[model samples]
Target: MDYSQLRFVVEIVETGSISKAASNLFISQPNLSNQIANLEKILGKNIFYRSNRGVTLTSYGVEVYSYAKALVEQYAMVEKKLMTRSNENKIKIASFGSEVINSQFFEICKRYNENNYEFNLCECGVEAAIQKVNMRDCDVALIIYSDFQQNKLGQLLTAQELELKNLFQGQLKIHVSQKYPLSKKSNITRKDLEGLFHVKKAYLFEGMFSLDYELQFLGIPENQKTILANGNKTYNDALHNLPSFAIEIDWKCNKALPSDLNRIPYENKNLPITCGLVKRKNEFLKEELSFFVEKLIDAYG
Candidate 1:
């Protein structure tokens, strides 16, 4: 299929409706439908199951959409370069989250942007971050996994021609408001947190690990009261306003989080987290990436 046709597929999937997608793409609904029909005939596979409610991808359509979205992104990148006549450098970053995000990370972005460079930073799960690197959509990725995950995850990354550089080991800890009853404790055991409300960061749909797995890793019981918050702000709010706790790879010195929070090491069966960088194998580091690495070191220190 042509780039425009693939672009059509990506737009439709993104908007989740042909009519809205048509509006966004500046095309008529009938023309968009015809384009989809022509593409389906070419591939001999129905790309979407149309309905009154909206369109959803068929089983095979889901597979097609993934590749189509990536192809669309690359095509647009090339088109932008061709039109502008300037080969601008764009730093694409895919990250698991807060363990690696600190003040120094943004400093690098600020430095690059001052020179008119572009950036794409996605806060995603482990699988999504790895997928971005594998698909060539990202220049580098920041990730965290226990040593136990490294045996399998390492091999898989190597097979995909990716390299993982361990930056440092992060201590996983439970954070609570200073107002929390157990906040004074230096080390937290499961018993100390038992029956308390918990605010947690959870990833969904992009290869989500079950809640049992999260609880197991945090050394908490299944019966513990839990609520889900998508980012640190909400996690902090929950801890501040309620008798709750949250888990994160300890970046206790982060100024972005509230000063009144208490970060206590979670003492349980050892879960050694390795925070690191992932990049394509044998790739030469760009100046921005080098600066990013140096600043990352400073941020961690």
Candidate 2:
């Protein structure tokens, strides 16, 4: 089949509806349906089982879709290599944490400039970052999740056909202003900050799986005096100005922390943090992207 039809199948699987995929592909629904129907006839197998909800891939359709996706990626790579030299030097990255962006990201960008490449970094939640990579909008994604979330996150990455590489693992710690009483302790427990306000950084796409979920898994009570901050500056302000505490991984807070704030290791063996890089599965990394990935491994791994 033609590359256009292959792309149509992949898009249909991605959107899970012919109407949605047609809208995205800028084609009429009837035309798209006709194309898929012709493809199935050529293959002599029904590719999708239709229902009110949407389309579900049949068993054989799964194999066809897999090969089609790889072919599409390969074709795109060839076209990009041959025709997109001007855009080749640009790398797009999405990240979940400001700490990662401020620390490793800037350093990587500086090194990338040595090769005369340009890069863009977007700060978003894990799901949004994954979507950017899956949709080929970004070359890579950097995200941090608690060890407790490993299984769920793994399933998510698998569903999106993304590959993950571990950059760092850190123990969870509490960040509090130096003036706060809990800051005096070398280590703190859940009980120590019972009455103090907890500054929770609001995530864009955390869903039901997040730091709060991890805390609940650790048997910690939900923060009673909670304040939500939409961004890093506001989160830091809450920690500095108010008698509040925030939880973060040790390595992330090791740098870019205010002088007035201190990071105290929380005495919980159950809560660990993992930071990593993600990219499309089986996709070839361009020269600049490969170089940057190595720099990240050297710096953090």
Candidate 3:
């Protein structure tokens, strides 16, 4: 019924604890608890399942959170529209990649800020960022498809009510460490990948998906290859631990390569990655949001 209640729910989901959300919101824990209780009473559903580790959204909670997020976003939009009329508007957006997080996206935002606009930016993982856009939590979502799965990416696009406008295609290659035995060979064969330990990004489910096909192509026995899923840490940490090879596309990989890492070019191969801006349906899009997406593609292309 109120903005603070909706915000309290969102903050709870974000921080994963009532205490932390209360601390961040600069409110009392008991007050926050009472607000949530009142919200639950109105909604007739439990928004969070509590545990020792933290809180998890129940199925009902997920549904409520999605709608609540959309309502909050629309409220922000109303505020922005009012401020824009008064020449005090600020654009709030979120992205899902390291490059975007490291200020790669600023060019587009800066270009659009010609009206002396303020911008609020947040960065998160690919899936999570998409979710935010889908729920109308942010104005736009930009994601990269470094790894692909059968219908998985497509599903996300459709399920999230997003459209992917392809910016450019980049090459994906298998890379190895210079110390590895394969480093001596100019190129590796499909048969050479057996008994290799594969280092994968634990956070990215797609990392495992990409490796499945690569392994199949290499004729490597599934059981022999060890796929280790790691957390938020980069793949560089797993380099020495396992004889790992990851797929990297040309555009993204060129800047991403480390001096010590040797890139075995998948060479004129079809490992192209397509990066783009994702937005909700046409009805949800506004003029500034459309211009923002256009500028992103233009800046990179």
Model 3 residue 288 distance off true place after TM-score fit, in angstroms: 8.3
Query: On residues 38-100, what C-alpha lDDT tens digit does candidate 2 reach at each position?
Result: 999999999999888889999999999999999999999989878865644777888876554
lDDT of each: 0.77, 0.79, 0.64
Comparing 1 and 3 on TM-score, the stronger one: 1
List the lowest-lDDT window of 10 residues for candidate 3: 248-257
Q: Model 3 compared with the native: what TM-score?
A: 0.50
Going through the candidates in the order shown, the clash numbers are: 0, 0, 4
Residue 100 of model 1: what lDDT? 45
* Clashing residue pairs in candidate 3 (N, C-alpha, C atoms within 3 angstroms): 171-249, 171-250, 172-248, 202-230
- Residues 242-270 of candidate 3 have per-residue lDDT tens digits of 77665433454333323455556543345
Q: Estimate each model's TM-score.
A: 0.67, 0.63, 0.50
Distance (Å) between predicted and true CA of 284, model 1? 1.1
For 1-301, candidate 1 gives per-residue lDDT tens digits of: 7888999999999998999999999999999999999999999999999888999999999999999989988988888868985437788888866644645567777787755567777877777788899998889888777755667777878889999998767666777888867889888887877778877777521353223454476666554487787776776788898888877666424235436877787775445567688899999878988898777766666
Give the CA lDDT, 0 to 100, for residue 255 in model 3.
31
- The number of clashing residue pairs in model 1 is 0
